[model samples]
Every structure is written in C-alpha cells, then in structure tokens.
Target: MNCFRIDESGYTGFDLLNADQRFQGASAIAISDEDADRLIKQHFPKLQAPELKYRALSRREANHPRLIGLMRDLLSDFRCVTYVCDKRFMLTLMFVDYAVEPFYYERGFDFYAGGQNYAMASMLHMAGPTLLGKPQFEALMAAFQRSMKEKSEEALRDLVAAARATNWMELPEVLGPLAKYAAPECLEAISTPDLTTDVALIVLQSLITRMEVMSEGRYRVAHDQSKNLQTYTEFLQRFIDHDANVEFRATEITSLKFPLKLTAVEQVDSKDSPAVQLADVMIGAAIEAANNLAGLRSGGLDAEQVLSLYADDQFIHMVPSIDFEEQKRFRQGSQSGELIDYLAGNVFGPKKR
Candidate 1:
C-alpha cells in the first residue's frame, strides 16, 4: 500500500476571518518509508529546534538560495498534493449564509442574523489592513458602528433579509458600489461548502484519487498529530464511511468511481516522521507561491514561475485551479449568470421546502 504524510500551514483556529490570517494550506507527500528515511538522513540530518515551518520559509532570510535549491531537489523524490484556501472570500460567504452556524455553534454560541452582522463587521475589519487599508477600514467600521448605535437589531434583521433575498450570482448587485472594493479573487473563492472543510476534503480526495490512478485503490495516510487535525480526520473518516458509494470529486480531472478505502489513518509526530517534515516544507513553499500570486509577498521567485516547474509535472499537484481573471469577470457580472438561481434553488427555504 502507498503511504502518504500530510501537514498544514496557516491554521488560525475557527476564526478564519482574522485580519492576520491570509491563507490556509494543506500538503500531502507520498513517499516510500525507505526513501523517506534516506532523504532525511541525507538532507536534514542536523535538524534543530524550532525546526523548519512555512512561515519561516516565507521570509527571505530563512528561504535562502541554498535552502531553496535543497527543497527543489527534494521535490523530485515524492508525489505532492496541495490545497490553498482563500479565507477572506470563504468567511464572507459563510457570514451571509447558513454555513456560519457551524463556526459559532462549535464555540457554544447560537447563530442568528445579529451574529451575521457581527461576522460581517469582523470580516470587513480584518480585510481592512490588507485590502481596504487602514483609513478605509476605519471608515467602514465607523459606518458599521453608526448602524449599530442607531438601529442595531433592526439593521441586522434588514441585512439578513437582504442576504436571504440575494444569491451568489447577485453578490455584485447586493454589494452595490462596495463590490468594487471587495477583491474579485476574494468573492470568487466562495464555494458550496466552507473553505476549510473543502480543503480538507480535497486534500484527502486528491490523495486517494492519485493513489488509485498510480497504484491500486489502496493506501494509508499519516498526518502530523494535532488535536484539531485529529478531530477533522475522524469527521472525514465518518463522512467517507457513511457514504461509501459517494463519488469522490475535486481532483484535477473529473470524479473517481472507486470508493476510497484506507488501510489505516495514523497521526505521527513531525519530529519523528521524515515524510511529515517533507510535507511541511512542500506546503510552506506552496503557501509562499500563493502569497506571491496574491501580491501579499514579493522579492522571491514569482508564483507562476515556481508553479510552472511543477504543473502537470507528475511531482506536485495543485488543486482546484484558481482563475483570477474568470473570477474577476464573475464579480463584474459577466460569467456564471445562473449562480443566483442555482443558489436559491439549493439553499433551504423558510419552511425547509
């Protein structure tokens, strides 16, 4: 059976809309146990404390040319899969929809229209430092504060009512002039399910899909041990087991017919697992590439250039191609014209009809 190790970058708890949080990425590496040990002994024999992490690699000092070269070399030895989340757009969609319930409910709070307003305000505030700038963020905050002070309950109800009336297709109109200020990429990142859940599913789905395509439909997965990740894995396993016949989507191609059967799902310490460490490095690099593409970072390899080296190269798999241009057009009300109707049809009605 093929063995894979998984690790993640930029996990900021359930507060996906935090101003400092930009991206959430998960990386999986498929490598033989023998090769994993060999590579670790050869390359990271002297691994130290506060060992390599994505955030450190994102910095110019930590991502030195030599280290980059070493990472490039390591890429050749394993099959890699990565999923990056656009938190801003994900949170925005959640705030306006029923998806926000899970987030608040998980924290012992009941979700309501008032909660939606609070979430929207938080999202806007978080976007201020990066997308809107300090001044605009303050202005938006002032507007929100005024609304709260004047007619807090009524305003929240109105906002919720408006959101209920609108759909994904009508986001631009619903947002009005404020739509322009919202990044096209952000708006486009919205998906049917929440972003974190989508990423988790995609990562596992892609790993299993690739395994089936390369080998048989047999594999075991090992992920870096963490309480939060453990919960996610258990939830995902339940999801998979509950619907054995459900087709796996979210691959580069179309759906996979074969049901994913894991020989075992294990969590291991990164300190002991070379495969997990490699996954960490690869995910960090993927995050840096994404940040470069999003204009959040610079003075290093361009994202497109780095991605091209791995594109369809059989080594690295980039999941769910992000088309900024297409997303921009969608934001401008050009493409996916039926989005509103589609959403309206899918979303629950007042009477659950």
Candidate 2:
C-alpha cells in the first residue's frame, strides 16, 4: 500500500509501503501514494485511480487558519489525513468546487526514521462518473448551482418547489450532487405533498426558535441594556433551575472598577480587559454557531463537504509605517530626527495587506 509515517522526530511519504517496518512512534500516520491508491480502491470500489490526487501544505508558507481555509477550499468534499509533518496533507477523489482545480505537482524530500525519505505525487485529478450518464451529472450540478444561488429562505422555498415539480428528487439516489442542496424542511414538505397539521406546527416552532436567536444577537449588539439584563436574568433562572440544590456562582460579571486610574510610570493593564479569557471561547462559539446554521440549512454535517466556503483565507495584517515619504525615511534609517518625526507623524496605522 502507498502510505506515509511520522514517528516522533522523523516522517516520510512514499508510493509504496516497502519500509513499513520502520513506522514507529508515529504521533499521527497516513497511507502513502501506492497504499493510498489501494485503500481508496478497497473502500470506494467504484472510484478509479485516475480520480485521486495528492496535496501537501507547508507551515512555512501558511498559518493554521489559512491552511484550514485552504483545506476547506480544496478538499472540503474529499477525504484527507495529516501525518504530523508540519504540513497540510491529503488525498482527494474529486474536486468539490473552484477552490481545487488544475492540481499542481511538486517534489522535495527530507530524512525520516533514520533513513532517506523521498516520494513523487501529483496534486490534481480529473473526475469522471463511474456509471451515471454525463447529462445526469450535469443536471445534478445544475440543481446544486441553483441551491448555492438561493441564499434567502424565500429563494430556497422557490428552488425546492421547482425541484419537486421537475422531479429532481430521483437524482440524489444515483448522483451525490443534489446532496448539497437537499434541505430537511424541503424534504419534509415534499414527503407530505399536502402540508399536514404536524408539519405546520413544526415550521412554526422553527420560526419561533430562529426569531429568538436573532433577537438575542440584536439585543447584545444594539446595547439594549434593559433587554440584555432581562435576557441574562432569564438565563440564570434556567441555569439555576437545572440543579437547584447545587451551589452556583456567576463566572462572568462586569467588574465594578473599569478604566482604573493610574499615575504616570505606574504600569497597569487596561481596565477594559476581560477578567476571564473569552476571546478564544467566543471564537469557538462563533465557529460552532456558524457550523450549526450551515448544517440546519443544508440538512447534513460533513466537515469536508463545506470546505469550499473558506478556501480564500482572509485575515488581518499589521504593517508598521507612516505616510508616503516618512515610510521611506523610516525604511532608509534617515536619522534619529527622522525616526522621531516619523513616529510623531502617525502613532498607529490601519492594518494593511
């Protein structure tokens, strides 16, 4: 089998498992070129070898977020694994979207497991259906494209209506293309062509739930102090009610002293800082909520399936410089006077690419 191994300090990727005996102490491991080919053939019998491709990502060229975003873009719908090689690595059977195309081929190698390590692989593949007709695949893709274009609920309703009217439901069984656009609510409505009382009730319930969530976000962002306080109080009540006998303490409370007064030369962190580390917690919550919303809309949860959305990694960058001539002056190290003048020109500049 083509496979790769990463044993604590050494790692290697290859076309065959000839050196399988050397795989030891691997924090994470994955199959290589030849083994990978065999594995895919074993599990996805219908998929052909020509449809598979190798992709590697290096830490030196991209950070984790950027790497993840790229992974989502290129292999969101494909299976991939990492082998603790400080790189994003994966093998894909198909291109999910525009994020991955015209795959490139490159080569370089390093030592692994007390021996020389080297391998060759291509990063792209051309997709062809195993049995489904080309026109069938094309129609399925058209449905998917229609779904992607319908962002609003009303638009989604229209697409769902049109799909049912045109009999696209039968396509999902033979082609995976419609899976991206198949929504649960639409499925329910389709199953019960006539809206039953239960279906109506469920739709109403979902609407109420969505409205409550939107109201909460609005309250927080609009600085509606009264609403925020009321919402917090209700949350505490529900939380305390969950285990009435247990002691409970508020973990988050606005500090009584904010923007603490300090004399010159007395170092103190900004009082605006949070008492607890919430930046990471909030970021995680945001990711989870977004994931949930995406799942609710799509009616499926495939981590790889949604990768294309984040392919173009966007991030903030900070560059230190002043206006035109002064930036050049600073770079040139004109003089001590120039340094002071540049510093005085602008204390901070906006983040730039």
Candidate 3:
C-alpha cells in the first residue's frame, strides 16, 4: 500500500513511472482535507472511532498501483473502466464548474468510445457543484455500480430528468438523421412496427440508457484522434438491432377461459413507427394474462397473489444498436457469477423440467 501525506510545503510525494523504471517528482496530484479523511475510512473499513484519525496527511501522485488498482477494481465492480482510462477527460470534468471550456462539446466520436464515462461526467456537470460534495456524488454514482442497488431507481429517475433537460434533449433527432441514410424498406421496417404506450415507455427508457452509454464511448474516441469513431457508429447500429430484434422463447402465463399463446417480438423501439405501439400492447396483454393466471392460482384474487407480478419476463428485448458480444464481455468481466446468472434469468426464467 502506497501512503501519501501532505507535507509543510503543501505537496506530497509522487512516484511517476517511466518506461523501464521509476523517478520521484513533486506531487502534482491534489488532495483536499476531506479527501484525506475519506481515504482513511476506505483503507480501514473496520476502524470506527477516533482511534483511527488522520493523524497526518500525505499525498502520493503515484498511480498508487495499489490504490489506483483498487480503484480500478471498485470501478470494474461498478463498470467504470470507461471513466478511469481517460484521465484528461475526467480532469476536464473535475474542472467543469470552474469553467465551461471548449473541451465540453459532445462530438459524434464521444457518442461511442467511453460513453458511460461521458454520461457520468456530463451528469456531474449538469447536476453541478452539489455533485462535487462527496456524499452527493457517491450517492448518485453508486447506481452505476450494481444493477439492483437500493435507490438505483430513484437515481436513474434523476438521471433521466437531467438527461432530458440537457444534451439528450434532441434524442428524436437520431430517428430523423438516421432515417436519411437507411434504405427506405429498412426504414419502413424500422418504422412500421406497432407498439403500445407502456412498451413505448420501456423502449424510450432503454434508448436513453444506450445513448448515455454511447455519449461516453464517443467522447473517449473523440478525444483521441488515433481512435476511430466509426466503431461507435457501428456500435449504435448493432445496439439498435440487438435491442429490437434479438429473440428467444418463453412460456407466458396466460388467463383466458381458453388459454391463448402470444408471440412477443423482442427488441421493439418506441421512437420507431408503429412497432413500438404493438410491443406496448403485447406487454400490456401479457401483464393482464399474468394477472389472471395469478388470480386463479390464488383463490379469490388475494393480495399475496400479486407477488407473482415480480416474476421475470421470459423473453425481453436487447438493443440491436449495441454489440452483444462486447456487452457480454463487459458483463462477464465486471460482475460476479450470480449477477451474471441473474441477468440471464430474463432469458431462461424457471425452466420446465
């Protein structure tokens, strides 16, 4: 563990790594008094009392292979590699409040590269200095760490609000712009699907997630001329396909005097023409069917029967715009086996023996 302390000179020690070895330099890294205190709590999780105090303060500009490595670990745990890899971007993000430099523009390339990072950083910028006040930032960012974390829904709602109010205000523009390039038949195919309000809402929500991620991804590539933005454009296209067309079969619980089977087409986008309307109706119909089944399973529509409402959908949609392989690789590397299994639950549900 590399320990950094604040010296009388207002600087700490930094070990910057060069190609073959290492050289010591004055600490260019800055640490606030509050940051030092939090650092202690992080390392000594069990230390509860004044017994563990910031007796001294030090700053190490080291990539603190250990500390930075742990940060990478926690970030991976939260799927944050997209943020850390681009230190320059984060630095700009940190300074966003001090100034809105030309660096803040969201180029098309940034839409694909480190998209999540860009979303987060943009979120922080939009959410403002309140976000800089440690507790607030941690609370807000904690949502990105786990799929099922507490308050994540609330955090996401906040994100939705922020996204809608800011750069994402023109999401509908994507539909119009892309419509220009795609084949008329393909565009028609994309546009003609029918969807209901409920399904449309879900589709909109999913697109928001995708776009936020894309923003970060594009930003990463945009910042680096060496990086190509086309990959992100391809990513967007694939994500759209996977999210709208990827399909699997599931036995939906239904409730008619005579049971009926519903064919659910996965990956329906709401902003697309009629298809979104159709998907919404199907979802609604499915819910109605599930409710009927539950009511029958439990005598006389007891409240407890509603517990089944929590059951996972057998076949849900993935965005075709994303690269499923890339997403899968991301999930496999960052999450635990159980978390991965939980995600797959939507695919397999309770398999019939």
Candidate 4:
C-alpha cells in the first residue's frame, strides 16, 4: 500500500465567503518520510523551530522560490495529486445542489444529470447579485449557508424568509424562474442537515477518490492534526467504504476498482510527519498561485511556475476555478469585465429540456 500525506490551506469550515477564506487548497504526496526530510533540507537548509509545516513557505512572499523548487519535485519525482476549489463558487454550488436541485428532482428531473446545477451555480456566482440585486441575494445565500451547519427550525424559517424577501428586492423578470424553488415548499430539502456537506471535508473526500483513481492500490493516509479533520474524519472514511454508483444523467462517473481502496486514516503532528509538512508547502503554494491567477491578489508567488507544475500531469491534479466580474467589495478587480465578456461571447448550444 502506498502512503499519502495530505495537508490543506485556506480551510475555514462552512462560512466560505469571508475575505480571507475564499478558496481551499489541498495536496497529497506519496514521498516517504526520509525522502521528504532530505528534500526539506535542500529547500531550507537552515530551518529552525516550528518546522516547515507550522512555518509554511506559501505563507511568506520571500519563501516562494523555495516553494517553486520543491514543487518541481512534486511534478517530476513523486507525481503528487492536488485539489483546489473556489469556496465562493462552492457555496453557490451547495445552494444549487442542496436547495435548487431537489426542487426539480422531486418532479422527476435529475438536476445534475441534466447538468443544470453547473450552469445555475455559474450564473448565480457571476450574475446573480447583478440580476437579483446584491444585498437581498447575499442575504438569502447567507441564511442558506448558516442553515447548512445548523438544521434548526429557526434557521429554516430565516432561509425561507430570505428567499421570499427576494421577490420585492430582486428584478421582476429574474425572480420568476427562481421563486418556485426558493419558496418555503422546498424547506425539507434545504433544511435537511448533512454532515458530509462541508467544504474542507468534501475536498479531502474528493481528493482521496481522485488519488485512488490516479494511483491504484490500497491506501494509508497521514493528515496534519486538525480539529477540522477530526470533525469529519469518520465521514471521510465512511464515504469511501460505500460502493455507490454516481450517475450524471444516466452515465456512470465512477471508474475506480471496487471496495474503493483504503487501509487507514491517521491524524499526526506535522512536527513528526515530514511528508505532511511537505504537502503543506505544496497546498499553500497552490492556493497562492490560484489567487494570483484569479487576479484577486497578485505577485505573492510565481503563477506561471506553479501553474506549469499543474500542467505536467493533468489527471493527478484537479483545479477548477470560477472567476468572473462581480460588484462585491472583496471582488473589486472583477469589475474589469474580461472573464464575463469571454463567457458571454463563447459559442455554446442550449441544454435539452
């Protein structure tokens, strides 16, 4: 069995749109402990206290070169697998999948099967605020997000009120399509709490599956000690044990060998685990590169070099970005309108009804 050490960056539980926690990055490496230590010495020969895991290279601007150098090893030597997601986009996806999808599914339509969830999430993320008026839409999203963590009747009522509040607050034409689903009738779907609906937990779960698919065999995992991981570790292990089929519109999405291979999950101190620390640098660098790429922040790391490492092996890396113009305070530069223009001008066929 191959041992993989995994670490995460920008993990802020469920409230994702906070200014500092916009994206979640994770990297898993198969490098042995001895090799990882040797590589660390080369990167930071004079490393002192707190070690590389606690003092991550991706955190400081000065250490970016060493991060890129180490990332080269990930690209060539170990062929590490990584995962990154725009948390804001992910929240919108939860809004669509959890709340909106069920509205249609109850009527016998498969929301994901039809691939409407993707389009809906993208549209909402990029233009929902503009179409519906930013304040009310954000309020509605906030209520839904809070209810995801707490499944109380009060939370459900707030979400329903937020949805209905949009009728008067949003543009008339836009509310017609959304009003039905957002209506309180769909409270059962929206209010049903799911432990597995968490972002960090979901990232780790998806990354593990992708890792299994990329490198076949039973797996042993070592993760950095975290309350977050501890919070969802059971769900993570349980998620893999099930051999359920994931069909999107009558097509199978799972191709990994049966019983879904996993041997054990161990939470370890990064001070003791060389590979976890190394994985930390990789994940941190990936998140920095994503910020630079998204134009949310610029010049903390080499976007070109970090992104090139991603191109080396496509299957082992899953980096999905949802960057577009928006009027949000944190998304100030999004007003440039470059991405939105491209999205609009792209040629595409309409989905089948």
* Best-first order by TM-score: 4, 1, 2, 3
* TM-score computed on alpha carbons, candidate 4: 0.79
Off by over 4 Å in 3: 1-54, 57-148, 151-155, 165-353
Please report the candidate that would top lDDT against the real structure.
Answer: 4
TM-scores, all candidates, are 0.59, 0.17, 0.16, 0.79
Q: Per-residue lDDT for 73 in model 3? A: 29
Worst lDDT run of 10 residues, candidate 1, spans: 344-353
> Which numbered prediction scores highest in TM-score against the true structure?
4
Model 1, residue 99: C-alpha shift (Å) = 8.9
TM-score of 3: 0.16
250: Cα error in model 2, Å: 27
Two-way TM-score contest, 2 vs 4, winner: 4
Native RMSD of candidate 3 (Å): 26.6
Worst 10 residues of 4 by lDDT: 343-352
Candidate 3 residue-wise lDDT at 246: 26
Q: Rate the local accuracy (lDDT) of all candidates.
A: 0.49, 0.24, 0.25, 0.63
The digit string of per-residue lDDT tens for model 1 on 317-350 reads 3322244344333234221112222222332111
Error of 1 at 179 (Å): 14
